[model samples]
Target: MKHVTYADKALFLDDDSADWLMEYARALGSATMTDTVTLRGIGMDGNEVEATFLLNHSTELITQTTQSGLQGPKNDEAVGYMQEQTRLILTPPPARSVDDPLEIS
Candidate 1:
């Protein structure tokens, strides 16, 4: 177990804080990356939520997440994930040309 002390609030944190948290987690015997944290709670509307932080190991910012039981944010998240999947796939039809009135497809 490693023991170290560091400040919790810093406008801009440096390597010392990162090493400190990693060392502390290791001291606690954690086996995963230190930047990942899971938050679980019931919001004011009484819905339970589980949000996991997806972070850049170096930046420690939540770049993305897997949240449960939250519809609005999930729907918003889907737009970016599903854009490529929502395309129309059409078999080549007769008389279709690259300069057609509508899109070639």
Candidate 2:
């Protein structure tokens, strides 16, 4: 499990979830954008719960491994989505040509 500290709140998430969240935050910062994301994680009581975070250029997120005996929540789909979003931000698609053959007159 990993601990993600944002502002004054800390959330315990799985390794992938925490790592991808950090990377996505960096990408969002580079793009000068803002977004809200929620991921399943271990709450203060060691039970599974959803934690939300706001990512933006001025926001900061920290992650670190934890030795808690509780198993972290598995959020593969959310992790994948965040990874893809980060990729898109870091490597955006090429712009379409205005004079392309497919353009309608």
Candidate 3:
């Protein structure tokens, strides 16, 4: 498990998920955009819950390994979305040519 600290709130998530979040955040920051991602994790109270994070260029996140024996929550859907978003941000779509209606000869 890993402890992810964001601003004043934090969540404990599985290793893969934690890593994904960190990478996704970096991608978003590089693109200078913002996105929201929800993941299943353990809160400060030691209870499993869904946490939503708003990632942006100004966002700051810190993740650390934990020694807790608890199993991290499985959230394949969220992870997949994050992966796709990160990929898109890193490799954006190619620009298309716009047809102009006005022609001055």
Candidate 4:
């Protein structure tokens, strides 16, 4: 199975920048990928947050297994493994309110 891991830290930015990161994550989740991808989770600091994504192996096979329960879908497992590791370092958080600034900000 293919594996992809990444991390982000955006605690230095102001509230606006943090919000943008959240939007960016949403966009990324829907973004296209040749392999099966899963959103692990995100860490938040006031308006800032860190996100992670994992690309697993036999994504198409897994999807087919989940949907059809049939094997041998052209054996594109290696292709999935060749996927690039992706990470995004965000600056200038989005426009949003940070509740309990003392804890996160």
Best by TM-score: 2
Q: Give the winner by lDDT: 2 or 4.
A: 2
Worst 10 residues of 2 by lDDT: 96-105
Model 2 score (lDDT): 0.87
Measured over all alpha carbons after superposition, the RMSD of each candidate to the real structure, in angstroms, is 16.6, 3.4, 5.9, 18.6
Per residue, candidate 4 scores C-alpha lDDT tens digits across 6-105 of 3432123222222233343343444543233322222232232323333332211111011222221122332222221223322324556677355465
In angstroms, how far off is 39's CA in candidate 1?
1.9
Clashing residue pairs for model 1 = none
In angstroms, give how far residue 13 of model 4 lies from its true place: 1.5
lDDT (C-alpha) at residue 72 in model 2: 83
lDDT of 2 by residue, 1-105 (tens): 898888887879988899999999999998999988889988776677888889999987889888877778798988988999998999997887888666478
What is the TM-score of candidate 3? Answer: 0.86
In order, what lDDT does every prediction score? 0.31, 0.87, 0.90, 0.28
After best superposition, candidate 1 residue 97: deviation in angstroms? 70
Model 3 pairs in collision = none
Model 1 has an lDDT value of 0.31
Regions more than 4 Å wrong, model 4: 1-10, 33-105
Expressed as tens digits, the lDDT of each residue in 35-101 for candidate 3 is 9998999999988898889999998899999898889898888889999998888887776568745
lDDT of 2 at 94: 80
